[model samples]
Target chain A: MRHALILLGVLMAGMGLSVEAGLLGPLGEQVGHLSATLSIFMVGALLLSLALVFAPKRQLGALFKQPRWLLTGGILGPVYVIVLTLATPLVGVGMTMVGILCGQVAASVAIDHFGWLGSEQRKVDGYRIGALAMILAALWLM
Target chain B: MLLPLIFILLLVGGAVLAAQSSINGRLGAKAGVIESSWLTFVIGAVLTFLLMFFFEPAQQATLFSVPKWQLTGALFGVVYMLAIVFAVPRVGTAAATVAVISGQLLMSLLIDHFGWLSNAVRPLDASRYIAMALLIGAIGLIYLSHQQRHRRLASQPS
Candidate 1:
């Protein structure tokens, strides 16, 4: 029972993310997508900043010595925004979403298979393959 | 074709998302999770500002006129980013992703059914129900696989 609740909590967080992301499309229609992207990140930055103020400071200097790859996450943020902004109009929201899902599953599987980006190396077995197939089917149903 | 290219971009976007979580997890290992998340948003804000300057004119009129709730997308983003930062390291990327995707599908169903956030009202039909069930199954399989793998590794001699 306890484990089930934890799983439910994770699912709820995921759902929250999706619902918020879903709203971005309509919001973007009112404001240009680029402008909306800017606004979204701006809000995120503001909120994050507020949270950081109360948090204890860390030795951030070590980050400069880490592999350049570890620090490059910021670059991907704009790419995601651009893709959502551009793809939604061309393929419609549903198709764009499905495409993103497909990409995510495929990428996750590959990343795990290779242990890329410090992820644990997980083998590509039949069960995971089947799981991917189901995800694609879910996309089709959507 | 333009269609294929858009699909490609979406795919790349998803991959980038996975990378973003992994990178943030690494940074979180060094700096605290909240600090890492803040830095990411800070860099993201700067990049977005530059993009806005190039691609979009400052639409001050529409900006202020938008419903207050619409601006909450970023807050949602903060929640999601924080979730990823916390989950990826503990759960491993694949399992964490499956859990997140399942959550997304469930919420998406609710959103479509009620047409929340101005989405079109999509009734929860048989197909939708089946897909949700399949996702639950997928999540189960992914979790089981992770457990088995861990068990097998643990049983082996160090």
Candidate 2:
């Protein structure tokens, strides 16, 4: 049940992400993707800081001492938002997501296979290749 | 050419996102999920502000005039980021991403169907349904393969 709840939370979060994607395209039309994404990130920062105030305090400064790689956790988010915002108007949300899935699966598989990005080396064999083929076919069909 | 480039950018963005989850998960192992997520927002805010200043023109006037609901994109983003940060350590990055992809596809279908948020309405059709089913099949294959790999590794002596 605990695991199930976690998966459910992930799923709900995914749904929320999709909604954000949906909103971003139109918002980007009114304001440029960069401007819109900047605003969103600012809002996210505000919301997170508010939550932190209520939670137990930690040595937040310690995170700054960590390696640059780990500390830059938030960097990719704007990249994703800007790209999604740009693609949505052209391709629509479905195809945009299809394209994203393709990139995600390819990158994830590569990361596992090569142990890139500090991951354990998971082999790339026929089974994994076949799964990727299916996902590619699915994207093509979409 | 522009369209394809946009798509490619989106793809790279997705790949970056996968990497971010793994990175953030590791970060979370130290600082806890909420704090790690907060840290992410901090860095992201700075990066975005710079981007907004240089590349994107100022649009504060248009921004405030828009519907209040449109400003809520950040709320969804926070939830999404927090979920990935928490799920990555528990389920591992690939499985967590697959779950996210599934949810995204489902919601994307709904949004396209309803034309929500002033989006273009693309009604559901047989091809789209088949496409979604294929995605599900892909997810099953990935999940099953992941499980088998886990079992195989577990049985091996450390």
Q: Which tens-of-lDDT digit does each residue in B31-137 have in candidate 1?
A: 67787787788888899889878878555447579888888878778887887777677666776677788889988998989998778898899999999988898
Best by TM-score: 1
Top candidate when judged by DockQ against the true structure? 1
By lDDT, the best candidate is 1
What's model 1's TM-score? Answer: 0.91
**Model 1, span A19-138: residue lDDT tens:** 777877667777777777778788988988888776677555666777888878888989888888778777887888888877887787888889998876889877788778787788
What TM-scores do the predictions have? 0.91, 0.85
lDDT of 2 by residue, B54-140 (tens): 887666546778887888988998998889888777766766776677677767877888898777898878877876786667556
Candidate 1: regions farther than 4 A off: A1-9, B57-60
For every prediction, compared with the true complex, DockQ reads 0.65, 0.58
For model 2, the DockQ equals 0.58
